[model samples]
Target: MWVVAQAPPETPVGPEFGKASPVGLFILVVLGVVILGIGYAFHRRLSRFNRRRLFAEQHGIDPFDREAIDAAMEEAGLRDLSRTSYL
Candidate 1:
């Protein structure tokens, strides 16, 4: 009588198998910085728009009229410059 021998199952085992590469960490850090930059830009734009809206409301300029609002804001800027003494 003869007996058959079966080989053991193949499985991965090593120090490098589950480790993350440096490139992956670099990409993650770059992505985070890019997201933060976009958020900052968006925040600046929204803040400027908010200032425009408040200015229009205070001076009774029609908020929807872009040209009028811009003209008024420009005049206001000149008026502010004239009133304030810069050293």
Candidate 2:
């Protein structure tokens, strides 16, 4: 009786399949930076809007009116100053 010989299954090569390549990692990092930048910009815009809204409410003026905002700030002795002060 002749017996048939079976070949072993081939193993996958190359540092495991489905791993992220250098280019893919770079792309992901770039995407993350872009997303973060967009989020920061959105946060800054929202914060400014909210600040204006709150100021208007406190001063009983129209939030959309720039002249009213300026007048209110002047009346309240409020000035825009940089956070970092030089001595």
Candidate 1, residues 1-87, lDDT tens digits: the string is 998887668856798788899999999999999999889877766766777778889999887877777788788763322223322
- Model 1 lDDT at residue 49: 70
Lowest summed lDDT across 10 adjacent residues in model 1 is found at 78-87
For model 2, state the Cα shift of residue 70 in Å. Answer: 2.8
Error of 1 at 44 (Å): 0.2
What is the TM-score (0 to 1) of candidate 1? 0.73
lDDT of 2 by residue, 1-87 (tens): 998986668856686767867999899999999999889877766776677688889878988897888777778887633222322
Q: Worst 10-residue stretch by lDDT in candidate 2?
A: 78-87
Residue 40 error for model 2, in Å? 1.2
Count of residue pairs whose backbone atoms collide, per candidate = 0, 0
**How many clashes would you count in candidate 2?**
0
